[model samples]
Target: MEALLKAVVAGAALHSPLATLVQNDGTEVVLEPPANKGWVLYTVQSGDTLIGIAGRYRVDPKAIMYSSGLEGIKLKPGQQLRIPLTAGRSDREPRVPPGVEPYTVRSRDTLKGIAARFGVSELELITANPWIPSLDRLTEGAVLHIPTGQKGLLVRLSKGQTLLDLSGRFGVSLLKLAKVNGIDNPAEVAEGDLILIPGILARTTYDNLLAKREAERQARLEAERKAREEAARLAEQRRREEAARREAEAKRQARLAAQRQAQAQTQARRQAAQPATVRRSNFVSEGGYTYPVKSYVITTYFGRRGAYQRYHTGVDFAAPHGTPIYAARSGQVQVAGWSTWGYGYHVVIDHGGGVDTLYGHMSRFVVSAGEWVERGQLIGYVGSTGWSTGPHLHFEVRVGGSPRNPLAYLP
Candidate 1:
């Protein structure tokens, strides 16, 4: 063992926080703190061997040798030895108490199911039948022992039902339920495993059976409560959305109506010759503004119109989603982001002649505000953003911040 420790000291020290002790066969063991009971001092008696001393103390001989620091198996009278008392029940094997009866395991039998039926803990059942290999995988037709003295209804645990929850439903103590199932960790209990309850009968004639029915009803109520809460939350969200939509629409309509009234009043002024002070020629491009998008059919014409909406400020062009939109004419971009008032992801461009062109409902933009763009330059893509029904482009020609027909300016 000393040689083994030396061989692994370097590697083991690098990996583990605990002091590792490697055996000769390359098996490693961690050094744990001394057991709670600690060690007892005993004097070597006449004809006492290391093995015999270990047997007398019900401890491993190696533990005795290691604790005593004995180099060899040889022992002398009056030689001192330290016998370790394990922290817990290391020497004693679990046994069923008297009055327990043996039960034959039937097909599809589980340790939890057997213990629940017998009103005992799965641990107690397992403790009584030590010959059984595993708790998770029990064999059919295997004999098991029923622990003595239990009173309760045997019920299989349901999915998502916690032991604490079950205990409350059945009027059983939580600690007792945990104790019976050998469940050290309540969180680790297997779903659908049968477990025992004390003082509850499964028969319908008993009042305890009513507890089970009540529990089921309570579970259903909880589910329904959650569902209703979710539905109410969704409804509230929709209501707020509709309110916002109506408010935006009203504002848009009022703005458009004012623009139309202003236009009507200014119609006579425009009929006269162009003002000498106004440099309208500088604003006019060599060629007039072109269509922003190709292969688009006019859906909603510019002016007061539409079934759902009162006023149409711009012309709506039906275009496929992600269709490229171009600049109507050379201009500097002014606005190039989202608009909550039904004009989402729009851009406003100021052409020289107090005429600003607006493009609304775009999927994405290639240019930003304050950037110069050329005529027919790729500016954005068509999308059904804001209060649009389908993928389309809302094209507007704004003359001095007032809406104008885009078709009148476009070539």
Candidate 2:
């Protein structure tokens, strides 16, 4: 440049408008033809790169990009690019940095082919060009800015390997690796996907890495399968244990029920013995009856008490469970145990005069059936054994065999 400046002696007339700029700062002046050289409407040919196109026209790549409004666009054959024959005086060549270059994709071109052609790793090529839309496929005519960054290693992952693993093995940040591969979700990585280990030059010393990863994946799957089998076995064991427990519980309950039935049968045998001699009562029979239980509350009064109500045969005497009950009048004990009807464990006394007093809902009868007893004698205890709601005694008086209110007879 000093020689060129010295060659033009003082007062020598410079020919082009760019001469002044070139003379001012020789380094800043792009060595291209003057703007007067004019521009040509050039048809984009096959396999044309932006850099190659700018080189052919002696113009700045940025100038072409600006003129075509294709800063991050791909180039295709049959597309027209305005090729200025000369660069502007103020224009500079290689608009991008020194480590980066512009690449225009043409028809029948592929990312791999371009990468191999340029002896660059595909990962670097894609990363340096952030405008790339997808990873699996390249745009037909995308203008790529290829960055000559640190060399990269190209490796195809086998089954069960992922980008995360690649990042770990290759010492690359997961984020950087994902961005380079155009991955939105790092976990969505697939096996057999092409991986570019940035900053690592292509080599074969790490051939065993993929095999190790595959083995690890197999081990994990086997462990998971064993865990599932163990869980199933434990569940089956629990179910069997539960079934056995329930069976034992059912057997225990059956044994208890059988014992109760046998005891009831033995009690029944004590009853229905020879009838006790009927005896007259010493106490005065006020209204021809006595209160069955000593201390109680009249719960349900006998006779129709409400409209549309049925004739309540007996007066319900509410008392605590197991409260002692007495005979209403002197009579022979008729029925003395469980009554399958509404009355629970109960007793009935045939009070001789074609009248019988029924003491229902007894817990147990101390006096057996066919045994005669005087008025106010202890016969049984209060209970809710049959259809009775609570610990209460149902007391009734009868005319012939028909039920009558015991309340009318009691004092």
Residue range 143-254, candidate 1, lDDT tens digits = 4557575544445456677888888887878898877666777776644444667555434332332454577779999999999999999999999999999999999999
How does candidate 2 score on lDDT? 0.67
The C-alpha stretches of model 1 lying farther than 4 A from their native spots are 1-287, 306-308
Judge candidate 1 against the unseen true structure and give its global Cα lDDT, from 0 to 1.
0.69
The 0-to-1 C-alpha lDDT of every candidate, in the order given, reads: 0.69, 0.67
Q: Which ten residues in a row have the lowest lDDT in candidate 2?
A: 272-281
Clashes of 2: 5
Local lDDT at 340 for model 2: 83
